[model samples]
Target: MKNYLNSTMIKITLMIVLCMSAFAFNDSKVSAKDEAIDLRAKAAILIDADSGKILYEKNANKAYGIASMSKMMTEYILLDKIKAGEISWDDQYNVSKYAYKISHDTELSNVALREDGVYSVKELYEAMAIYSANAATIALTEVMAGSEKNFLPLMNKKAEELGLKNYTFYNATGLNNKQLKGMQPKGTPEDGENEMPAKYVAKLAYQLVKEHPDMLETASINKKAFAKGTDDEIMMTNWNYMVKGGIYEYKGVDGLKTGSTDFAGQCVTITAKQGDLRVIAVVMDAKEENGDSTYKARFDAAKTLLDYGFNNFKMQEVMPAGYTFKNNKTIAVKDGQKKEVAIEASKAISFIANKNTTYKPKLVLDKKEITAPVKKGTVVGHVEIQGDGYGYIMPVKDQATVVTTDDVQSKGWFVKALGGIGDFFANVGHSIF
Candidate 1:
């Protein structure tokens, strides 16, 4: 009995091991089919501008000092105010003594606004966006909300409205927290320096451009004169070197922002478009080269991230609008004049996937059998595209019109008579009511 039991136990163990081995093999195959991206930045993300889908990320949720990139939000709010008629491009604002001092500090990025010098909203914006000028940004902030102190609430409110969860702003200029301490309004405690997860930054960038595409007009301009041709007209150059004619300029690269500080290291938020598709990439705290004064790491990382997105992905049409999936597309119908109803995709859908991949369409019906009396535009099911290392669902398109087929028209005369009687009574009741 002992020998028989031992043999039986060995057999059971062998079967279990075989099953585990098979499952492992299958998991590996699935894993091999997926694509991946790598980044050298401490935190980074690449996302589709339209869908807001994250295509790739590394340490994306880790908070890092975003430095001047915070100006993206400042500019966004500024534009909103301008659109609401609270301010205008031609409206002028006076520079405060504080702004002038910060501009000349030599430690902070500035466009050197003279105390008492007045600049139109447009000119100050050009300086801030193009040069990452802290002083111009602060002046604009003061003008917008009465003072930098009163502006924090508005900025925070906008942040919440935009669905930002991983960030908090200390000042409008993205200045270091220490420099902004005195600027905080009384009763409002310092929240420290501004920081955000790379993903949130990417989301903000996408939202910024989506809501105000014209902002790109400012971002894309690599060179503009702030007081043109005057001795004070400083030729402000965009710090984002990835734009046209910049050192790391990539084809189709346009306006955005660059940032760095002792704490934030080096960072950048970028957007570029090719055809109808646009991509946003954010990189923060990239490793610097020894003795590197130019902050080359952030730019290099941004290039790599953008190239990875443009080169590895292609937008493929899963289904075009008004496409009729008629071939074997009939869906079974219950109690219908017709045995089956034809179906198609309801709308067009496109997905970004690997360049060389192919996708297969799959129809998933809400129910296996669609009851009769279906309308022309009824949503019966959804289409799922498989392959290409990606899969997504879209509403299925069905035939233009479907009603009980004539197959039921010849139903027994008794049934037809009953239907006529019922209609007569329903009409009578309606009239009486």
Candidate 2:
């Protein structure tokens, strides 16, 4: 009997050891996965383009030089003007001395423009979008705001209107003012360049892609000859090599922007689509293991972010339609046949998250109690999602409308009057007490 008891004890100990081993193995796997996604950039952000859910971030709020990526603001402003009928693609612009000089500077990206050349808005926009041509960008600013100096105010005003809280725009071309050869905007530092946090950069890219998807047509062009069959024609190549037929071609990568400068290093704001899943990634000032910035480092960081998003997370319905909040299923109704009315989420809320993620629904009522005679489907407030720490890229998109589940009739007039009298006496009694 003693030998049998000792054997049983030994088996139990072995079982516990095996269970502990399994748990430790699982924990190590998770830790390795978390460590594998490190980004080699000064700032980075990954967001679900469709739902505006942030997947990952690193130093996302710290401001850094954006270099040519600043042209995205120029693109947004131009697109806004075209949408409002304030300008047309056919509108013609005369190259200014600033634009003319910049175009002739061989060190910069530009299409040479003859002094007497008249160019249409479409041509210059294509040059700016496809080639990151500084001269073409400046000419468009001249067309829109009369000069790049005047366009500075427009950029800041639009940034404010778009809820971009941290940003500074010094030029339309995204060129360092020192490179402008004393032509930098008045009252601005001569060596200044455009700067913004990674979050704002992602926001600007999000707004641009959402509002003006048509811009992708120009931005996606891999290579095009400017002024074909003319003496001044030059081959304009897209700086975003991730586009189709480029060195680092990525699937579903059609539009966006790239930038590089001594101060900014290498930066890219990339967008990609797979099936119904769309994601945007921004990598700013990417560097090598040795701490030297390189063009490939930006693309590498962006690729890692994009892969992490597409592989780890998927868009799923976190909260179902008609879902009821557990703690607040019904709301009080004043003078109704029933004392309360049932409420539910009017629509489903979906977002990108991992399989292990969980969400809780929170109901926020418009008022403490709704008036009687409420109609079914009447909006009461909104249902918000409380996730497992991860927040949304756009918090407003994570809400669903909350509505009354059924109609409630008003109480009989005599009953309401009697209840009112009883309530008054009760109040008086409480006050006397």
Candidate 2 per-residue lDDT, tens place, 117-169, comes to: 88999999999999999999999999999999999999999898788867888
> Which window of 10 residues has the lowest lDDT sum in candidate 1?
390-399
Q: TM-score for model 1?
A: 0.77
lDDT of 1 by residue, 273-386 (tens): 877768898989887545353468888888888887788776767667555555646677655566676666776667675565555666666777766656666676676666
TM-score (all chains, Cα) for each model: 0.77, 0.84
Q: Candidate 1 — which residues are off by over 4 angstroms?
A: 1-38, 185-191, 229-231, 289-294, 320-330, 357-362, 386-433
Error in Å for residue 383 of model 2: 2.0
Task: Say what the RMSD of model 1 is.
Answer: 7.8
Q: Which candidate has the highest lDDT of all?
A: 2
For candidate 2, what is the TM-score?
A: 0.84
